[model samples]
Target: MNIPGPEPRSDGGVGAVAAAGGLHTYQLRLHAEYGPVVRFQLPGVETAVSVADPVLLEATAHIDKRPESLFAFLAPLFETGNLQVMPAGEHTPWRRLLLSVLAGRPSHERHFTQFTALATALADRWAERAGRQPVELQKDLTELSLRMICAYALGGDTADPGGIVAAFEEVLTEYLGRLYEVPDGGGREERTRRAEEALAHLRATVDRVVLAHHRGSHPDKSDLIGALVEAGERPARIRDTVMVAMLAAHHTTGVAVSWTLHLLGRHPEVAERVADELDRVLGDRPVPEYADLRRLTYLEMALKESMRLYPPGPYGARETTVALALGDYEIPAGATIFYPFWAVHMNPDYWPEPGTFMPERFTPEEAAKRPRLAYIPFGLGPRSCEGAALAMAEAQLVLAVLLKRFRFRPAPEHEVTPTERFVLWADDIRMTVSPRRTGEEAR
Candidate 1:
């Protein structure tokens, strides 16, 4: 079956989708122009098929292998072998272990206090700067998310939080830069050298934490690293796990919260509703407890709706291990099947006024009317984000705490644009915050 797409250009087919701004924008255009299953060319992959229809997504949901070539940029960060290319048999056990640690309610409950405290601390800082300067939403939130993840994963030995965050950022920036750069570009050796240096710094940092834990100097079996150690994973494997978890946890949650706040900033009515919900749920309390999360129903809906409009991880891909039939098309084995989540979320058939920031779209009754796969901010299938529950909990708690304490309005002259850099990121989500008066607020 011939899938519809642009004719490939001679510059290694990069031009097939280059005209549409970034990859995420290109995908939106591809689906808008050529229906659901649009064939395109991606760097390193032969032929890519993007599926936007949620119903059609159900057909290829079970295939779990990622395109290894596409994820090769991450290979340098792992020492016990690349988790991205692990065979299905081995992948299952690894994924199960991750889910047990990351997806369990007990873990989330155990870490709730720490998460809220970190968020509250940041809010306090922002409170100090309340009329002083615009708060850098992505920068500050990413730091908060990093600190939270480190505390949860590595225990109390995270003495050098700045060092760890810097190292991780350096490593990620180096690799992502290479991944997005034109293939066969100049100065390849220098880029490789810098990436290796960053990788080494990250590995060394993880080694110190692991060694400290094992020696009983910083023993904490309740944390993520502790769980992995208890599960009898090797030191090298544990390092890989920690690095990968940090990589996944760091930006995605921060970006999600940032986007949600940006949306709330633009729509004061929605922000007022969120404040009302927070006011009703946590009447006299400053921060929310885990139980309070369930009561913030409207806040949850607004967060979900924000993600539907701007999913942190905009797209997901799986390479077919067998001949896959999606809709009326048969995708050959080894072909890359792209799940353009942004496109799916914007599909007009499922979401009316797909571009509108209407939080009611995610209310329980309205949500039940849509297909299960229609709003997969985390994704679908077995290899989906194992930290979905944890991420949502963290995001909601942070949003609740921040919104209740302060009012966020977008900076006067700042323009926020969504760009894909391994995740949906806006470099300049400049928003001003003002402390809400105790009685005057939430009215």
Candidate 2:
């Protein structure tokens, strides 16, 4: 099949589509301007059409089955045997351990106190810096999220959130930047080296924590590391489990927090409603419990809506290993198919007024009307994010706590746009935070 016209941009801007010879740009522009499914091709690659088509999505369940499509892109950060890279069955044990830690009452109870403490600490910090001071919620939330993960997962906070995060950020930035620049052999090798260096640093940190737990010499340890170490037996599994846990827990939460804040700032009415929801449900409190997450329905809906708009893992790909039938086209073995959620989420056919920041779109009644797979922020079918439930619970708790304490707006004259690499986040968002009190509290 010969696909014609428009290709992925070679210049590689953030949010750029992945195709050859301007195919990504074509798909991005055409999906908005024309219809869902568009034909595109990359130079030196086979002619392949990218589908934001809902009908096509239904026809292809094998999309994420191959690791090479999405996981290969991440190979620089994590090795082939890592949980994210392994075949479905092989990854289950690690997933089970993570699920056991992140799910259930004990984990929730342990995490609730930590989440509240971190949220309170953050709120207090912002309140102290009150007035017209510009506070970067993204940075603050990133720190808070990483800290929570470190404290909860790695025992106490040994991982420097800012420092380690910067190292990983550098790898992602450099690699993604050079990815589209002619695929130079030497450049790719250098990028791979840097990635390995960053991963080695992080892995070493995890190893040290595991070793401390093994030796029974660490104190003040109340996080996931302690929980796993205390479980007894299976030392190697425990180490791999924690490594997977950290990767799963930290980055995704940061992205979710960033997007939640970005959406709240973009939509004042939504933020106000969220605040009201918080007031009605949870009044000023020292900390909130896991059960409290259920009461804040509107806030949860807003998070759902936000995730729908900007799923941190926006684009997922899978390489084909066998001939598959997809709609009218026969997808050959070894072909790569890209699934861009950004395009899928914004498709008007699936979501009316897709670009608008309307939280009500996720209301119970409205939600039941859409296709099951239509709003897959955490992804779909099997292999969906194992921590989806936990992440939502944590996000709701944090959002409630923050909305209750302060009010924020999008930074003036600062355009916040999605910058895509591994996760989608606001490029430059400078927002001022002010303590909110209902007149009587102003004094």
TM-score for each model = 0.94, 0.81
Q: Give, for candidate 1, the lowest lDDT window spanning 10 residues.
A: 434-443
lDDT of 1 by residue, 231-339 (tens): 8888899889988888898998889999999999999999988988888889879999999999999999999889999999999999998898887798999899999
Give the poorly placed runs of model 1, Cα more than 4 Å off. 182-198, 212-222, 440-443
List model 2 lDDT by residue over 1-443, tens digit each. 43333445554322334422233234557566546655544443453445676667776653445544344444455443455657667656645655676665666666677778878888899888777577877777766776666666666556575556655555555556655454565666776677668767766776777788778766645456666666662555555555555556665776787677878877888888887777676666634567777788888888888888878777665556677677656777777666667777787877998878888898899988877667777765445676777677777777777778888877678777666545666655667787776435654
The lDDT values for all models are 0.86, 0.66
Cα deviation of 267 in candidate 1 (Å)?
0.7
Top lDDT prediction, candidate number: 1
TM-score for candidate 2: 0.81
Residue 162, candidate 2: how far off, in angstroms?
A: 6.5
- How many Å off is the CA of 400 in candidate 2? 1.5
Candidate 2's C-alpha runs over 4 A off are 1-27, 42-49, 62-64, 67-70, 79-82, 103-105, 157-201, 215-245
True-structure RMSD for candidate 2:
4.6
How well does candidate 1 match the true structure, expressed as C-alpha RMSD? 2.3
lDDT of 1 at 203: 74
